[model samples]
Structure formats: structure tokens, C-alpha cells
Target: MSFQQLVECATHGQTRASYVCHHLLQSGQDGSMRPVNWVRDEDEHVNAWCDECEEYLQSHGAEWNDKTEAFAKIRMICENCFETLKATNPTKELT
Candidate 1:
């Protein structure tokens, strides 16, 4: 998807511009949602994550696996939320 479309998806169609990461849906320290850096290898595309999420994704998987390509757009998350998700989904894998 184009960058514009990704922005729209992140803001729920709002015109406000922001970056968003595909993994966890939360704003960064700046209090604005932004797209995470992406690492693409051939057909495999993965969204970068914060330190905690990075460990989780690395332990599990890093490939983009959202059912809807639109939702596949990435966003950042706070450290607290990262720990929460990691604790809640101990066995969850991003595939």
C-alpha cells in the first residue's frame, strides 16, 4: 500500500499525518502514532518494534501476518503496553 493510504489507516481515516507501526497500536513518547521502520526481504516484510516487542517478535516471528493488508500497517507502543502484551501472550507468535 502507498504511504498515504497507510497514514489514513493508522488515523482511522483522519487527515492528520502521523507515523504508525504495524505490530502494537499505541503512540510513541511524542504522543503521536507513527509507522515503524520496515525490513523487507523478498516477500517477507516485517515491521520494526520497540525493545520489548522486538524481543517478543524475534522470539516468535517478524513477518507481516495480518489478515487484512490494510491493518498490516504498523504502529508503535509504549514500554508498559509491550510488557503487558508479552505477559498476556506468552505463547503468541506473529506469523
Candidate 2:
């Protein structure tokens, strides 16, 4: 399964460009959704996350953190999602 497949399955075929963009933005791909001073932070670096990260965050009850302003701007995700997917389905790498 590729990322698109996984997205389709999760979204029940409601996948759209905006949805992809939203997820990508949420996942912090290419630092597209960074804060004003996000790049200035010494520890701030946008790293690409796998499909596991995307799905896992939703499954693990990881909510947005408005206080830190990182969840929305930084595209934070749940690490547990990646761990679970990797442990359960190593081959699929989701589409």
C-alpha cells in the first residue's frame, strides 16, 4: 500500500488535494507549515515523517497543542503511530 492507498482507506475515498495538502502540512513535510520563528529555533528542523507517523497520530489520540503553537504550525504527529505500524506491518509502507 502506498501513501495514497492508505489515505484513501483511512478517508474512505474522500481523498482530495486539500486533504493531501493538509496532511502533508500537518506532517511537516519540507517545513511548509512552520511558525514565524520556527526556523530560528536551534532545535527546529522539519523532518519528513513516514505514513506511520501520519496515521499513528490520529489513532493515538494526539490532539493539537494550541499553547505551544507547534501542533498547527509545525505539523506535529504521534510517534506511537509509526512504531505501531512498523511493528505490525513492516512490508506495507502504506500508499
Candidate 3:
């Protein structure tokens, strides 16, 4: 689908812009990825990306002293992007 169509489709329900951002961020990780486990309080399952995205970021400017460090960086970067998108598009407030 076109980018606009993707946006339109994603915005049609209770889904928030942050959710969209998360998907986009993870899209680069892999298209066919899925969560391996579920949480009791959350509606959707929590998941991690394949090694591709992690390796991609590591090859770039991202630094990691250990495996946990890499994971922390990934979470920080994703949250930063999500918040930036949210701040710039107040109309698309995530409720």
C-alpha cells in the first residue's frame, strides 16, 4: 500500500501515533517478526526484533559495551523517535 494509505489505515482505530512509530521503527527490524511471549496486563504481546536491526544499528554510530547495553540503546532510540513524532504532531496525540 501507499504511505498515505498505510497512515489512514493505522489511524482508523484507537491506535496511537506512538504505536505507529513503534511499528515503523520495528519495520526495519523485520517485516514478518512476531512476539514470542505475552504479558498479563497488556493487550498485545511484547516482542523483540531479529538480529538484523541490532546489527544495523551497531554498525552505525550506536555503541554497546555489552548485549544489555545494545538493548538499552535500542529502547532509548525508539522512545526518542516516538516522543519526537508525538511532540511535533500534537493533533495525533496518543491516548
Candidate 4:
């Protein structure tokens, strides 16, 4: 939620912070990942998720709750890696 704390990454070293879905934090790409939702907090990257979680969220009223939160399994990540995931993943149109 907040990026006030910094982390040390082997590849990225110390960098800005972000939160992402567990699936989006995976090591390899299966070409199924996408940037479904993202919010920028001033300069912080905030959070992002994939299409699957987006659909789940929509079905669950598109808000954080007990089940949705448990389903998402979101976790902390570095902005650098977040950028990489965003670049490799496409955006899904919700309509």
C-alpha cells in the first residue's frame, strides 16, 4: 500500500517499491500475464494484477474483501521487476 520502505534485490539492488499478484511475480513468462489494474501513488508504483485476478475481483464486486484478498495473494515487489512484468504482459480491456 505504501512504498516508504526500501528492499535490497540481487539484480535490482535498492529500488522503489510496489505490490503485485503472486502470479505476476513468477520467474518465467507463459504469455498469459497482463496488467489488468494499476494505481500510481504519487511516484510509487502501488499495485498491479493479471487478467485472471481482475475477473475474479470483478466477480467479487471488484473490491478487496476476505475471499478476494485471499484469492489474490498479493505480495511486495520492487518497481524495477514490476516494470519488467508490465512490459512483458499485455493489458486486458474490461467491458
Best by TM-score: 4
lDDT of each: 0.38, 0.31, 0.33, 0.72
| Highest lDDT scorer | 4
Candidate 4 least-lDDT 10 residues: 27-36
Per-prediction TM-score, please?
0.28, 0.20, 0.24, 0.76
Clashes of each: 11, 8, 0, 0
The 10-residue segment of model 1 with minimum total lDDT is: 2-11
Superposed by TM-score, candidate 4 places the C-alpha of residue 12 at a distance from the truth, in angstroms, of 1.0
Candidate 1 residues lying further than 4 Å off, grouped into runs, are: 1-3, 6-48, 67-95
Candidate 4 local lDDT, 1-95, one digit each (tens): 54375767778999777877787776335656556567765655567777678789999998978888788898888888777776777754333
Which of the two, 2 or 3, has more TM-score?
A: 3
- Of the two candidates 1 and 3, the one with more favorable lDDT, higher being better, is 1
Candidate 4: residue pairs that collide:
none
Q: Write the per-residue lDDT of candidate 3 for residues 3-95, one digit (tens) a residue.
A: 211112232433221223133355445544422111111423122332443455467664434653445333313333443333433222112
Measured over all alpha carbons after superposition, the RMSD of each candidate to the real structure, in angstroms, is 10.9, 14.9, 14.1, 3.5
> Residues 1-95, candidate 1, lDDT per residue (tens digit)?
33332223332443323322444454423354333333432323233444444544455565345523334454433333433333433233334
Deviation (Å) of 94 in candidate 1: 19
- As a whole number from 0 to 100, the lDDT of residue 46 in candidate 2 is 22
Write the residue-wise lDDT of candidate 2 on 29-88 in tens digits.
Answer: 344332111111123222333343444445656432452223323333333332332343
Q: By TM-score, how accurate is candidate 4?
A: 0.76
| Ranking, lDDT, top scorer first | 4, 1, 3, 2
